[model samples]
Target: MTTPQLLMIEDDQRLAQMVVEYLAQSGFAVTHAGDGAGGMAALERQLPDLVILDLMLPDADGLELCRRIRALPGAAGKVPVLMLTAKGDPMDRIIGLELGADDYLPKPFEPRELLARIRAVLRRRGEGGLAGGAEPARGLRFGSLEIDRDARTVTVAGQAAELTSYQFDLLVAMAERAGRVLTRDQIMEAVRGRELEAFDRSIDVHMGRIRAAIEADPKNPKRILTVRGVGYVFAKQQD
Candidate 1:
């Protein structure tokens, strides 16, 4: 298997070098870009399998860069992005996901954790299957909401609904087990192959983003229903 190629778009040279070395050791071919513009130029040269984007950049905002990446033509637009945020703020991570980042790690993180996150994101990008081998067939339909597993696409009312790679997987996990109330732990484990972090609202944030894209009214979501203290469930009756 060819090593997965990755692009690191970060302005901090020292930190970027350290991450590059670590990821390279873990069998990734990494290309370093100093800033957003440099990152764009690198993309023009050759698009990597994944992108590690820093939230802060000299030339352009990370969120805007993420939007631009998603706007790129064809498969480039669907390339998975993992964001790095220096603030360690929940809102920052939330915003990153909302802007199309597949996953995020706050700055001053352990290299091992970053590696784990990267693997998880890549796994969701269909580099591999879930705990079980071989995914089900494509086209999971529910009223106006349609999920195409093969294409990794979602649409509501015949309109495409933009979702991060993570969000799409999470939605599939829930929708596959529709009518079942899944706790946060179950949802996290099923979708990410990991335990939920204590006090972490990452799942909630991603859920909100998914609802915004798929629900007719995000304020009052019907398909993905919340079970209050328990967790959430995808309604069996979509129509």
Candidate 2:
């Protein structure tokens, strides 16, 4: 297996150094950037398997930086972002997610947890050969909407739809079971590949993002229907 490259944008040099050294032991080659601009420059230098972003930087607000990263062109824009929120604030975490972060870890966390989270996020992007011996699933289609599993791309009327790594996996999980009304737990479990102890409200945010990307009218979504009191169902048939 090839070592996964990582870019960590953090102002704390000591923490960054420790993380770099620790992750190196786990076969990840890390590149560190002290601020948002340096981080963006490093990103332009080479795309890594994942980016570890700090919510508070000396030169930029991490939320604005996250927006900028999402605004980048092509695949660079789609690179998975894992945010580190220093405040341990839930609202900050939610805003980061709204701005397209794939995941978040609060400050003063265990290195082991960080490693696990990194591996989990990377796996969602189909990195690190996480699928093992299983055959890759084929693409799915519903009228103008096309989901290419291999490319990890989604298109609406041949136009690309922007989706974060986790959102893409969530969509694929539902698309794989069209017409079946899956509860929130089911949706989470499907995307996670295992059972979750509690429901994640973030899935609703992801679903909204998906609708905005693929539906003509997000307010009246036809492709992904919300069955109140139950869950959501991917329309088996679409225009």
Candidate 3:
């Protein structure tokens, strides 16, 4: 197994050191950046397999940093991000997801749990997230919209769509079950292979982002439809 390269952007030196040491034992190659500027410089220098971002950086807001990361040109933009937030407000976590974080861990968390979450996110990326014993297909298509399972790319009318690794997985999860109304809990379970925890509303946030990428008009989506109080459905016949 290849050692995964991870870039951790955090200002808390003591906590950063502890995490670096812990993850090293698990065979991860972690690079620590003490501030947003340093983190962006590191990321520009070398693209990592994943980024561990802190919600509050000394020089920049973590949410803004995440948005910048997504805007980066080429492959640097699409790296998976696992956000670390110390705030007690669930809004911070929700906003992190909205801004393209692949996952989030509350501070004061067990190192073991963080390790587990990291592995889960990476595994989902590698396996194409079709984890329920289903044979992997080549790809899925809907008219001008195409999802290439192998390349993990989505293109609308030949134009590449910007989707995070996690967002791509979420789209595939729904496309695999096209035309079916998926409840938020069902969507969460499909993507994460686990149910949401206590009133988690990140699903809506992510879906909105997904629509903005794939839909011609996000305000009036045709491919993915909201079903009133039910949930959402991927249109069976899309243009």
Candidate 4:
């Protein structure tokens, strides 16, 4: 089996070195870039399996860099991105996911947690094996909303909905279990093969993004219903 390659786009030299060593020890081949420009250059040379992007960079904004990365041609554009930010604001995490980041980790984090998040992102990308479970149906239809697992695409009312990879997965997770209410921890564990942390609203943010893509009225979502104090459930709609 080929080892996964990771590109770390961070300007903190000492921190970067420590991460590189730790991740390398954990069986990842990591490449370090000091800034967003350098990271882009490195990406041009060879697209890594996953990108560890730092929100703060000396040469460029991390959000813009993530946008550019997702705009790249071919598989490079589809590469999973795990964002690291010093800011502990929930809005930052939401914005990162909205910009196509597969996962977000606040700064001053433990290396073990970073490794776990990295593995989770890679698994969601279908690179770290099928740890989530058996493959879902090739196509799922609910009313006018269409989910094509084979193509990893979603369409609503015959119109293609633009969704990030993470959003798509979260939608499928709920859609697959239509009519069943799933707790936040249950959803996270099912989707990412992990548990949600205390006060972790990441799932809710991703749900909001998915609702915006598939729901007729995101503010009043009908497909994915919030179960208040429990979690959420995907409403089963008929054709």
Off by over 4 Å in 4: 44-46, 74-77, 127-135, 157-159
lDDT for each residue of candidate 2 in 79-152, tens digit (9 for 90 to 100): 88989977966777778877888888889999988898888788767741223345546878999999898788
Per-residue C-alpha lDDT of model 1 across residues 90-196, encoded as one tens digit per residue: 88877887778877788888998888888877886773223456666577899999988888888888888888777888888898889999998888877764442
Q: Which pairs, if any, clash in model 4? A: none
Using lDDT as the measure, name the better of candidate 2 and candidate 3.
3
For all predictions, the C-alpha RMSD in Å is: 2.1, 2.4, 1.7, 2.8
Question: Stretches of candidate 2 above 4 Å error?
Answer: 127-137, 193-199
**Per-candidate local distance difference test:** 0.83, 0.83, 0.87, 0.82
Better of 1 and 3 by TM-score: 3
Better of 2 and 4 by lDDT: 2
Worst 10 residues of 3 by lDDT: 192-201
Candidate 3's residue-wise lDDT over 14-120, tens digit each?
99999999999999999999999999999899888899999998899999999989877765325899999889798888889888898888898899888888887
Query: What is the model-wide C-alpha lDDT for candidate 3?
Result: 0.87
Ranking by TM-score: 3, 2, 1, 4
| Count: clashes, candidate 3 | 0
Winning model by lDDT: 3
User: What does the lDDT read for residue 188 in candidate 3?
Assistant: 77
